[model samples]
Target: MSWTKVVAITGCDSGLGWAIAARAAREGLVTIAGMYNGSDTEAARALKNLCAHPYKLDVTDSKSVTEFQNYVKNVLQENPKYKLYAVVNNAGVMTVGNYEWQTPQMIENMINVNLLGAMRVVSSFLPELRKNGAINDFKPRIINVASHCGLQALPCFGPYSASKAGLLAWTRALHLEHFRDGLSVISFIPGGFIGSSNLTMNQVENGNKMLSHLTEEQKSIYEKRIRTLNKYLGQASNNTRYDSLSNEVIIETFVKALIDNKPKQVYKVEPWRYKFYYNLLKMPFPDIMYYWIIKKFLAFPDSE
Candidate 1:
């Protein structure tokens, strides 16, 4: 295998995935962007412009994953001069509200796409990495994009937080298993709110529809949580001119991980204060009390 840095990223149609793919391409790394919406005009245009080869990869579909794996394998086998250097499992969907309100399918989708999807990509790409390893140019890396929610149980973000928390554990386990395999594993946790890209307004709209089945009291409590959360999300989305944190942080961090001689296992973006809440959740007495006080005000269903 030839030693040219090539990275495979899932969910490259938008958000941090898109941002990271663009950055990797700009850095002259051969970037394979696997996106569910690759047929979309915006994705097409960007793929063309960035020289990013776009693959229609639905992470939730086993067939699609197999196809992607075969395509990558074929391309590398034909060349034998280039190999996949990194895989970014960045495809994710966010869900809001309490666990009791979430349907079985909704919860399953979150777990499948956000958590299981990453596992699928890692497994599929392992063979290629091992092949490259035989040729002495393979220093495989896997970066899983988790969130601050992974570290803590927020008042109403049941599905999202649970999935991410599972991902965090999964990545840590992978890191422990392959510490000597020259496989650099990074689980990136971006704290606070980051602006959206591929996850458009339509997601929020559809999510609201799902919650529409709730009773008036449940709806009232849900609305209160949304009102508080929306304040932060809305500000991040609209107020770009005012200290807006870019998704580019994820791209840069990925690059650093790829290039660094000894990359750290976990990168918590947005700093200490934001990371505090997540760590606080792991604490004993005060942590439980802290979350209880906030949930008390939100008037959770249990309280009612």
Candidate 2:
């Protein structure tokens, strides 16, 4: 019998993770979806209907990751033909606020999930992936779902940006470390999908939490700015104009990163405007121009 390719994806509860999981199943790969919310949700039911294996996975918990790893090991043991082909580190969370406004827990949560979580999953599964690659004489890819904010930090996305930047750096280092082992590690920036994803779903809640931590004097100074930031974030999350590409478009780039014979170190799916702006930043430009453009684009409140 021929080898059957299998893929594991995290954050299958919603958004890009759900879309990508569905697409991967349709592509004839045996998909194992890791849903944080477990099998109770509509997404889990839908994935089950698709014949994809959906399991409760909490990347933040070491025990949960180990359990998920064991589950994958069982699948391989049960189906000898099955070879772990790829692992998609898609689990991530985000919040919006100025750096000072963000709480310690908020920053820690982003780092724990976006950066350390991916690291945990990768470290847990690398042995299996490397073993499969060696035995099957085929390369297995590790696709990290990164963000454009990682490339250029935005004002209200301090923690989120830092997390993604760390993820990207780790991706680069891992890619080099395992290149000769027939393991492909890369980062995929899904670009601006604010309208479609649950990334900024808790903007208001986060804003409230941030505001509660401030002194009365601090609150008087920062309340308007925080409110402005929250309003802008809400609008951006709801506005289709801010998110140009459909889920299908984003997943197509993801598929390319998964199946390409010579995949790039980074696969970025972004709008033309973002492409232009990012390119412009690469040129010999002044810092003021870049910040000015960002201030206008994100509707940042004026400093006192």
Candidate 3:
């Protein structure tokens, strides 16, 4: 704790990112918070007074990510003991609807933010990890903020789940690929939280905008279901941050993923009932059959 350790965390505008950045700063680590918005946002204001230094970073942009890498390098050069200890890829986006109902633009937007965005950040900051491993034989880490949906049947949250699944796979690959380099990569699969989660009216508003993209025929077929799904997801996403109270306790799994010397490849913290489903996904049942059964029973009938 006495040594200089820098932790860069993306998506600090809200939800898990803000909580983690705030918590890291409290723990005395140099926390760099990556935010997509300009300095006027509440996240910028709240994190400004703490250990977190909000940096403008659009993980999807090469120029932005390059700038972030330069920033980390400059920070490390200020002191020989300073190391870029970790980069928490926490920025993500979610769209709610049937997969077939999603427009090409919607699909691209989701992936660009959720999957490629994480990839861009990791690729950009990897060089700074070099100095970290040389210090006290310590390994720099990459903690990817994934979801339990990557582990099971997340239903209407398909696109978002797909992105997380890729993240899970990518994390595992990095863990293996960089083992000899003393770089630790892990995935944190969150179940739910005790405060207001990320999904909210903002996505509902975005979903409404996408509705305009549908053809008249398509709208007649999928409009009702899409609206219903978005409303349900808005409630579900916000509720995931907390079971009853609004607090930063939900960021514990993230902290564990970062500080543990030998972190689990996938650190999970969810509800009691998720265990059964988690096991269910791993059973010998064929994926096709399992999905079919899930759609037939667990999901409501699609609108004609």
For residues 82-115, what per-residue lDDT tens digits would candidate 2 score against the true structure? 9899999999999887788889999999999999
How many pairs in model 1 have backbone atoms within 3 A of each other, for residues 3 or more apart or on separate chains, i.e. clashes? 0
Off by over 4 Å in 1: 134-137, 200-203, 215-248, 276-289, 292-304
**What would you estimate as the lDDT of candidate 2?**
0.86
lDDT of 1 at 215: 74
Each model's C-alpha lDDT?
0.71, 0.86, 0.75
Clash pairs of candidate 2?
none
After superposition, the stretches of candidate 3 with alpha carbons farther than 4 Å from their true spots are 193-195, 234-249, 281-304
Best by TM-score: 2
| lDDT winner, 1 or 2 | 2
Name model 2 segments beyond 4 Å from true: 235-245, 283-286, 299-304
Compute each candidate's TM-score over C-alphas: 0.81, 0.92, 0.85
Candidate with more favorable, higher lDDT: 1 or 3: 3
Question: Against the correct fold, how does model 1 do in TM-score?
Answer: 0.81
Q: Candidate 1: which pairs clash?
A: none
